[model samples]
Target: MAAAAHQADRPATGGQGCRAMTGGDRDGAPGDFRLTRRQLCALPGSAALLGLLGGCAFAARADAPPLPSDLFGGTTADPYLLALRAYIWGYPLVRAAQVRQNTTLPADPFRPRPPSAAGAAINRLGHAAELATPLMKQGVAPNNDTLYSLAWLDMREGPFVLEMPDFGDRYYTVQFGQADSSTEQALGQRTHGGQLPPVLIQGPDQQVALPAGMVGVRSRQRYMMIAERSLVRTPADLPAVHALQRAMRLRRWVDYAAGTDLPAPVSDQRPLLAPDTRCPAPLHFLEMLGNVLRDWRPDAGEARLISGLRPLGLAAGRGFRLEALSQAGRAAAARGLADAEAAVRAKTFTLGRNVNGWSVNYGGSVFGEDHLLRAAVAMDQIYVLPAEEALYPNARSDGGGQPLDGRNRYVLRFGAGDLPPVDAFWSITMYFARGLMVPNAAGIYSIGDRTGGLVRNADGGIDIMIQQEPPAAPRSVNWLPAPPEPFMVMMRLYRPRAPVRSGHWKPPAIQKIGGA
Candidate 1:
């Protein structure tokens, strides 16, 4: 509600800064000056005077002021902001719709809120969506887009259950939101073999909600969702209303490239809620600020504002500057950015993973016939090499390579025999370090079995080039552009066999070739 309210009050400037222009005519040069040769000869002594007047006149022109610039000096900041806002508002609807289409939930109820665990899970998911926005924008990987449509099905009314359908591999886990007092209790029984059940985890009676914070595992191969929780109700009534609250607030984390290393942890404190249910005014203002970044065109002033971000410590790498922000300002911006990135990342990753899994059930009808999903699903499994393994040559065959430098070429080679075990086909796709499509001369971001014209090496060994520059003619076919900075990759396996599914068929580690 606070987020919505803030969005309403401070309509996004759409990236137009406070100093933006309101189109007007330029002031012409002064009318009194003369420059004829005869006049010049007669007024030699007055030349200095004319030059001064000319300078003043030029400075006085209406359009003489310099245009503003963006923090990274990029011109597309305005459009990027707009895209971000659209992503934030549109993500939830997309996820909810997907769940409705794929899962077998009973018809929507009048109130629709289920039990306490159900509600809490939904709310947690929603908060995760909010936190994911910025991370997604920065190119965090598969988790970036997957959270959009992913949901934790809570069947807690009778036998407590939580189902995460798209978790990689046939891998699924269920958990109890509350602890069981007795091992013999049905609540202690696993709904699905090896899976935990959902339980009612009660918070303090005086607590209204969780303060803005982060959650989820931070891994290149894992999807994450972080957010803030502020809804408050009596502990006794929590179970009754939890489901509805979660349904209304569910969100996902999204990352465009790979997940980021975790930031330093903040103290864990419950956020206080206003007496009224409405969000506070400062939050509204922040939302408006976000809107301005998204909707308004980047004018000179807007550019200046973006450019000032780094100095103000509000830009990427300057997150530490958050400490300097007013408590309220810091809380609002940090929470907002985190939520946005997380939501987008979760949606993207869920989609990518599912798409790769060839789970026709989850692919929306739109992609039912598309080759992309088929190609994604055909691949057996994607292995994410640990940073150390990826950097060192002898750490692990699955992880051997030099440390990943922001700039350098890397090679991930898979022998035909080592190909992922899959009943269908498979391919490897590459995204930018930021997780979006990379800008390559060939416009090809990924390579897979579905790649129609690929020419493989004679040795039955396929070498995929991961670097900033295009490979030589022969190797170019396997080249996947790396971001000018650090990035991540996901290898998908479709219809994976027991070997691939059971970890017997691990992916080869990405090896560093030459200096970046």
Candidate 2:
């Protein structure tokens, strides 16, 4: 597997560049770095007409057909098989579009494209977890300890290099993935040290002659992403982290060879991508799957499952026209998708072992190759840090095993020295069903150790107030406000310590205090 092969050959310098590479398959591509940082891949304001997979943009081909009737079989009524095929194959594209529209675009329709505000949703310097912010308004349950910055990249334009500055002892990472949300690379903390090495994304089967101070990690897709994460300790910690984010740059291949200043950002003017974030139906959903398959290189493990897709007008690089299918095939597709959704939901919950009420999951998630699990995750988030970098414990009920609700008050107390074990920081975020944040009076959605003014118990333990209304004045500072309905909470242990990693420190359950 490419992931495993990369792992074995990866340099372990902790982040400093070429210092770890022993001239890893150099292509010595000339004029590799000459473009301005901003011009790395300037996209226009439009979403994709059809998300052509494998670097094939829809409009570029002048032969795109109009939406057809009856995707599989014009006469069939059952769509179980077609539906299932769309659900699994189009999972990443649909998931990516979902997050982009919810987080960045407000006016766009249920089609695909780059979001408005010149990617306003990307690179937000977050404040403490207590207060609700714009990013929070998008309904993401993000951890409080890290300021997240994200942007889509077009690696096919040419190979590019990722450059990040040393953040001293702070924990940070740049997770990259293909258009389908498959794992591309996770370069930070675990890979290199503070002196960040220029990570390379080379051309197809092309060797990257990394410039001095650079290392190589090839990206399989021309269109990829950079999800930046930098740790934040307190409100005062934001500025420095933002600066580091600003310094983070991705330079084009030709620009790197210029040896001088690179040219300014120049847009390909190709319609910038706006992902279609719509409810998956039969025809439209299959259209999405067809496009994504153009780029996603299904490995041997996935080849068989995907092979089943080709018979249904889902072959990669082939144009999909719903009208082509017969009625029977389309009906089966629909039924398949609906059934897949239900099946995936049930399977997702069963994942990882449940320790106490919280799931102590270590692997088989966002970064893995499980198509079904990947679909479920896409229904959630496209990017997720590996367990070693961060561990998540989600609770839907109280310590006594009662479903949590805004109508009830509760407490999640930590015994002295028993707070979530983490080498960096820890936090607890509240989410309405489906992982969205519910608005509250306090303008707060989460809380953590770094939140200012949290009052501690006499024994050095901490008492967190959870409810819709504000708690009494004394305990208000530790309050994690909830919506006026059912809700769930997720505990984040960043850079989890040995104890937590080994499951020695299970997160204390949420103890119900009844309604106020």
Candidate 3:
């Protein structure tokens, strides 16, 4: 759909099933267990559209007319078809918008700095440890184990080279993605095994150098991102981590080869990508989808979904124009988007396996073929790493299956040495629905082994206080603050050990401290 020419042979269906490539190949399997996309489209009216959203949300309409030979494809498409098609297409696009919107901030790095200055940010280099800012709002999921180093690539300027540091014995990762936020590739301690390698990324039209010792290479979309995570153990570890961060550089291919000096930081901020969270609104979401379709590379099998979406002016370059649709068509399109949002919301909450109030997921973060699941997870938690890298055991309730809110006090105690089994480090971070990080007095957003002054219970066990108000002094030492409103907790186990990965080391339930 984009101007960038992608390999026409990139595998249409990811061998992965509904989740990531973790599952297996799902060939011409029924759209949702049905015979074909046509069968899925045969449902009766608008309700059918809602019901079959996950199955073949973007599959071409059952008896829909042919795609236009050009952009002005006239449509007799009813509201229901528009709704389903728009919703399915908008799902992933909204994530792209959300990631673009939140990470676009000036303070968080990923700002409009030129490629040469990418490695030298505000004097801090390509990565930062996030020492002081109590990050209250962020688009992507936050991990306390590792401080962040972010890079947003505008590949239109030509290909760039990412210099990877040999972070030996440390947990670090560079997650690569397109504007649509699909995790295209990974580089780090996990993938490359502590190798310091110069990586080459080829842009659509650029003459770039292939550096020596540049161990890995790949091609990506015009607008891309590389989110790097550098593990930081404590305040004492900050300086050393910063040193590692300073050494990592992102230079344009030509500059590195010629040792060309980088330009000074450029001017002013960009416009908003998406205003609201969850990207709940329909029209704006569809517009973002139209924008993505104009540039995102579609796989071979994705043609069917695109065929369905094209009629709505959401094709590669057509762009979704609400005015282009008739009054009834516009209304139907809105209704369809609304339904799709509702369905996506439902699926994300209930999709994973429920265990002790935690929706413990091993996969589904890295989307491949299952666009429905991809959209659902992007809504639930964007930029989540695949299980092997790290796993987020997310929870919104306590052990008794009661909803978690700061109105009540709670104690999550770990039996001696039972604190999340992991090789690198583990942390429990609290976040509210609207805000990404819970606002607390201590300027402390997360608690873990690295957190200072954590007190242990009598027998080497630990009690983590979870409540709005402060507990008495001694007990408060282990306090991980919570929002006064409904809150959720995330337990991230970096470089998880076999027990945790094998499901043998289940986390202790967040036991409510008092009935009151």
**lDDT of all predictions:** 0.30, 0.53, 0.56
Best by TM-score: 3
lDDT: worst 10-residue window of model 1 = 1-10
Residue 71 C-alpha lDDT in model 3 = 21
Q: What would the per-residue lDDT of candidate 3 be over residues 427-476, giving only the tens digit for each residue?
A: 88776532245667777677887777788888999999998877899877
Candidate 2 C-alpha error for residue 458, in Å: 3.8
Candidate 1 off by > 4 Å: 1-406
Task: For candidate 2, give the lDDT of residue 208.
Answer: 64
lDDT of 2: 0.53
lDDT (10s digit) by residue, model 1, range 339-428: 343333222323332221221122211233232222121111111111111100111111332233337777777786776666433545
lDDT for residue 178 in candidate 2, whole number 0-100? 58
Ranking by TM-score: 3, 2, 1
For each candidate in turn, give its C-alpha RMSD to the true structure in angstroms: 22.3, 15.1, 11.8
Residue 25 deviation, candidate 3, in Å?
A: 36
lDDT of 1 at 418: 72
| Prediction-by-prediction clash tally | 106, 68, 1
Q: Candidate 3 — which pairs collide?
A: 83-336
The Cα error of candidate 3 at residue 342, in Å, is 2.2
